[model samples]
Target: MLETTETATDPKRARILDGALKMFLAYGFSRTTMDDIARAAEVSRPALYLLFKNKTDIYRALASVVFEESIAKARAELAGDAPLGERLFQVIDTALISVMAKIAESPHGAEILDMKGSLAGDVVEGWRAAMVGQFTAAIGEEARATGVDLAARDLSPVMLADVLFDGLEGMKMRVSGAEEQRKAVRGLVKMVELAIRP
Candidate 1:
């Protein structure tokens, strides 16, 4: 009974999110209305309203799913009983680049970049902060496992994570061109290794 219920709900929600993502990527948040999402999803506007209160709610749910999945993947990459440097590089190569590429290739990638001015809401900012926090927490755990003395280190976990995420965001643009993402990723992995060296 539970499985059937979830199976039914999951597809409908996914359908909505898929449609919204396309439209949001194309026209952006503010410009893409609920009516647009309904038409794109092939559902009635009333149905969309029943599923989501408004654009903000739908965006929050969608962003949460993406962010949570990325964080979980990073955690899994770092969970292996390997050297800290090895695990960190794996996390960067597999998890971070995966998320970055998804964003880069996504039609909504640029729209998402312009989200704040378009949505002009706190939910977006909150999600951005949450992503940073998750990254910082993961890095701190990795540093501890590696036996790095935090007090002696020049970089705080928060600062390190911030730089890492920001650096990737910048790289996503530069590397996304001419299929240079792979080369860019390699450069990033080397940069991380150099930064974490004892």
Candidate 2:
């Protein structure tokens, strides 16, 4: 587990994270340095150290904040007045595809993604759980609102949510770029609409 000096929401901490993310995306996680972050953040190296133990800690904080924002966006999108398919599409778009596509566009995207395997296991796991929960809630709420008894089709909220998550994750691997990802997500949304539509 990683240790942190302060929450990412702290004004100073947020400034540090913004700089750290810029450095990481611009230079890649394996190549970015704490000094780079401090310079970009306009903090002395020692002052930056006072808030974050290292660059990786700052990176983890950014990931946490991004996850939180994504989940909140997804939840709000699900609760919107859009039609079911559009709402569901927005949920996945906001939560999954948006960040993934942003990273994939970065010059060091692959390297940064590889860092996730070694440095961000816990944060990544938490993100996955939260994303799945958001999907499950949205699906269940839609089902109830539309009087779709998923149990009659041998499906539960958890089941459909798991399938959606797994399918989207797989789709990421299969696609090459952001545009393809958006199109694929819509196809998945259409399939989901068919399953639970009234």
Best by TM-score: 2
Lowest summed lDDT over 10 consecutive residues: which window, candidate 1? 1-10
Query: Candidate 2's residue-wise lDDT over 61-98, tens digit each?
Result: 77777777777778788778888789878777766777
Q: Among these predicted structures, which one has the highest lDDT?
A: 2
**Candidate 2 — which residues are off by over 4 angstroms?**
1-9
Number of residue pairs clashing in candidate 1, backbone atoms closer than 3 angstroms, sequence gap of 3 or more or interchain: 1
Candidates in order, TM-scores: namely 0.67, 0.90
Candidate 1 residue lDDT tens string, 1-198? 112233256877777888887788788777899999998888998889998999987787666566556556666766678765566566666655665555656666766756643554565556457656766776677667677765586777788767766776687656655246556655665565555565
User: Using alpha carbons, what is the TM-score of model 1?
Assistant: 0.67
Q: Give the TM-score of candidate 2.
A: 0.90
